[model samples]
Structure formats: structure tokens, C-alpha cells
Target: MSGLSREKLLGMYQKMVEIRLFEEKVFELYGQNMVPGTIHLYAGEEAVAVGVCSALRKDDYITSTHRGHGHCIAKGADLNRTMAEILGKKDGYCKGKGGSMHIADFNIGMLGATAVVGAGLPIAVGAGLSAKLRKTDQIAVCFFGEGASNQGTFHESLNMSSAWKLPVIFICENNLYAMGTRQSRIMNVENVADRGTGYGIPGVVADGNDVLSVFRVTDEAVGKARNGEGPSLIECKTYRRRGHSRADPAKYRPKQEVEDWLLRDPIKRFKEHLIQEGTLKEAELLATEKETALRIEDAVKFAMESPYPTPEEALEDVYG
Candidate 1:
């Protein structure tokens, strides 16, 4: 936080708290049968999203994975609209069609989130290419899990972006599990960022739970991209506090592993850092949490009162 202003640091803290509370609320809503379909919570990986998005401009683009609520929130999506989208209400970002995993706000440069693994890579590459062709300094960020790193799209997108020097940042959130399948069982590589070397781009890894570490690395990448240095691959080693989806209990993981990651919880660690640094006091942190909780409650109320899309509305946004 040395180079960062007090306001920026506190903003990051607020965004992290917002994401944690929002995910927790989603968990509760899903359990109460108020939400439809499935959900992939972003409870533990708050730092990666906040860190990366905080480095971006409002006009910069971003693509997200199934576990993407954190990305949307970090990109400045309205909580009421985001909640409505998850609730499948008419007031949602995608007009209630995208649900939890597909929310998009083009005005904010949030390209969208997709449930398809590794799919967002190509889309982000496309956005980067568009920006390059338009001669804009805007960059696109791709947020995917380590599992998606093994996909052919990952290799192809990185290769093309590197060849053309497109402004895109490929972030691999290596949570170590691809829907309960451990990373050790899938890829042979020790780090996803290491793959960037093969694609002829800078590969860097950061402590995903440490907000400041993530922000600094991403800020550097953003500067390079804006300077036409092309795309960089950032592998954030993080953990998911919950299962792969709402239906998953994540029993596949060992108890010791879960406990270890919990101790490194990003939000808790950041709060402590802010307090210790005297950048924020305990009372201020408490007040922020209380305000965030109230905002989340307001969002929930809005989503609950919103109407669902009519049956005929399904075919409206459809195209051949």
C-alpha cells in the first residue's frame, strides 16, 4: 500500500468486504430456495478480483469464469442489478437471462461471465483485438481458474494475443481444484504462470490472498499492456472457501488443507493489515462492514421485489 492513497486502500478493503458478504448472502439465499439454478461462490478469492480490477480503468474490459461474482463486483457492477441477475429478475444485468454465471454490464466494460470453462479467454482476446484495432488504450482482463489453463483456448488465445501484441491480461486463479479435481491430478506444471513463457509473454505469480501483492503485480501488467507491451499471464495462487458449486460439499479435500487455507482468508488478512498499518481503525472497519451489510440487504430486497421475465421474453434476446 506504499504507493497507494488512503482512499484507494480503503476502497479495496470495502470491495473485498462487499464480495465476501455478497457471496455469503447468496449462499444463504440458495439454501433457503430463493435463488434458481446453481452458484459458484467467490467467498475466498476476493483479493484476486479486487486487486486486478482496481488496477483497471472504468473503460477497460474483463471476462469472467463461473465463479465470477467477485469479478463483476470488483468491476463496479451495481449490487442491486447483480443481485437481480442472480435472482433471475427482469431488473438484472442480462435482463434476468444470464443468472449467476452470465451477468454482463457492457457500460462498465464487464464483457460477461460464462459457465463454460476456458471460454472467456478467447472472448477477452477478441476484446483486446478490438481495442487494438480501434487504436484505444483500453485493455481486457481474463479471469479463469487454473483448470481452464489446460484448455486449448488458453494456449490459442495467449499465442494470438502475444503474436499481435494485444492488450490483454490473462489471470489464472489457481484454486488447485477444477470442480473437485485437484490440480496435481491434471497438469504437470507447478504454476500456470509458467506457461506464459512458452507463449512468449511474461509469467508472474503472486500471493492471491494478499491484496497489496496482487494489486502491485496487476498494476505493472496493466501499465505494460497500455504501453503496447502486450499481454501478461498472472497466476494467483488462491483457495475457494466453498465447494465447486452449490451442490458440492467439497469433501474431496482433506480437512487439514481446508483449515490451512481458511487461516489465510483474504478478507481477514487485509482487515488486519489495514488495522496494523494504522490506515484504518477497528471502529472504521466495523462501520464499513455494517454499511456494506445494509447495502447488501437493500440489494436483496430489490431482487426479491423485482419481477421475473415472462415466458415470451426468453426468445427476445435470442439470435441465430
Candidate 2:
């Protein structure tokens, strides 16, 4: 809010709201048996997706993880299609097959999300390489969790991106826990950004809960990538407010820790910041919330009215 334009800040605020409300709807719908399959909610980490995507162009590509709804929305995917996808309706982006974990909207630059841990890393690297070869200024971003940093693909992709000076940014959303395992329990490094040094790329850290802070760092990285300066590792330190997946209860997390992070809720903080800065009034924030809720309600209605993919269509999109 300090250096950013009013429009930019407002856009970021709206996106954070959309993600939060969308995920909340998904959680509610899933509980009511309105949606099928498991979902990894992106409630608390809305700032990361909004901030990073704010730094990208329409043509730039992004790869997302299983917890990907935030990424899809921030990158300009249609809310209706995304919601329909989670509901497994025929109107979904993947025609109900990909469900919650594999929603992709290539028209909006989202390559796709993979459920397998760390699988998106190499895919993002490949997209970067293709962009470089095609002589396009388009850059690629990969969003992975702290847990994926330990995977072999992380090292391999980072090393390869640095060696070739590919236009890619490796973003690690370090929400403290990788699924049920805490970061400290599995990794020796204090910061995931430190892993960037091994690949000869600049490693940067930002507060994943702070949208402005994330935008600042990612804007710099995207600028460098556009200028052919190569890849950078950005580690966003944040916390997830829910369990790794639905029905898990997240009892593994400390009650105090959850309460502490909830106090730092990115959407609430951003709304307050907007009001304090006079960019948006308290009443306007409330109105926005109401509007967002209605929009998501419409999405749910649309998904409910839509049909499901027929059995014959199962192998239609499948490729060997």
C-alpha cells in the first residue's frame, strides 16, 4: 500500500477476498455432500497467490499444486468454471474429470495442477524452456509447498533453470507444514530460499501473509525474468489455517499456533490496511464481502444445474 498504486492494491484485495470466499464455499459444499473428492483448501495463504500473480502478464504461465484454487483464481481463471470443476460438473474446466486437484485454464495461463508432490516443478521448467526457445518474453512460475523442496525434481529443475537462464520463478509456499509433517522435522535448512543458492540463482524471502511484500519481491523477480536474467527462488513464509486435506481435523497443529495465524489473516489485514490508508472505506469492504459471497453462490448454483460427464467421455481427454 505504501508504494503501490490504489488500483493495484484494490485488485490484490479483491483477489484475496475471492480466494478466501471461494475456498470457504468449497469447504461448506464439500461438507454438505455437494462436491466430490478431497480438496486442499487455500484459505489462509491467499496473499501468496494474489501477490505473485499480480506480477505476471496475461501470457505468462503458472503451474500449481494440489492446493491450487487460489492460484487459479488469482491468475484470472473464471470463478464459475473453477467452482464447477470442484463440484465435478460437466461445465468444469476439465469437464468434471480433473475435480479439485487438477483444475487448469490454459486460456488464462494456468498450465495445470498435479496432485503428485513436486510434479509441477519439472512441468514449469519445461514451460520456461519452451518460452525461451520460442523467443517469447513470457515467464513461467511454479508454486510448490515447503515439502516439495526436498524432492529431487526441485533441485533438478532449479539447477537446469539456472544453467539455461530460463525465464522462471520458483515459488515455495512454506506454510510451516508439508501435509502433516512440519518443515523442521524433515529439512535441515532454516529457509527454503537458501536452496536457491545451490542452483546459482538468487534466493529471496517474503512474508507470505503480506500481499504487498509478496508483490514487491515477485515484481522484481518477474522483471528480471523478462529481461532474461534467469530464475530466482522465492520462499514465502506463511501458515495454513486448515488441515492438509479435508476430514483431517488438523489436530497435529497447536491450537495456539492456529489462533495466532488466524489473527494475522491476510484478507482481514489487507482490508484494514485499505481502510487505514483511505483507499477503501469500512463500508466498502463489507459491501465487497457481500458481493463476493453472492458471486460464489451463483457459481455453486451453476455447478448444481450443470450435468456430469457421461461414462463414454471418460477416455476422451486421456492421452498416453
lDDT for each candidate structure: 0.95, 0.92
How far off is residue 42 in model 2, in Å?
0.4
Q: Ten residues in a row with the worst lDDT in model 1?
A: 1-10
lDDT at 140 for candidate 1? 97
TM-score of 1: 0.99
Per-prediction TM-score: 0.99, 0.98
Candidate 1 per-residue lDDT over residues 1-320, each given as its tens digit: 46788889889999999999999999999999988899999999999999999999999999999998999999999999999999999999989999998899999999999989999999999999999999999999999999999899999999999999999999999999999899999899899999999989999999999989999999999999999999999999999999999889999999999999999999999999989988889898899999999999999999999999999999998798
Off by over 4 Å in 1: none
lDDT per residue for candidate 2 within 157-191, as digits (tens), equals 99999999999999999999987898889998899
Per lDDT, the best of the predicted structures is: 1
Supply the TM-score for candidate 2: 0.98
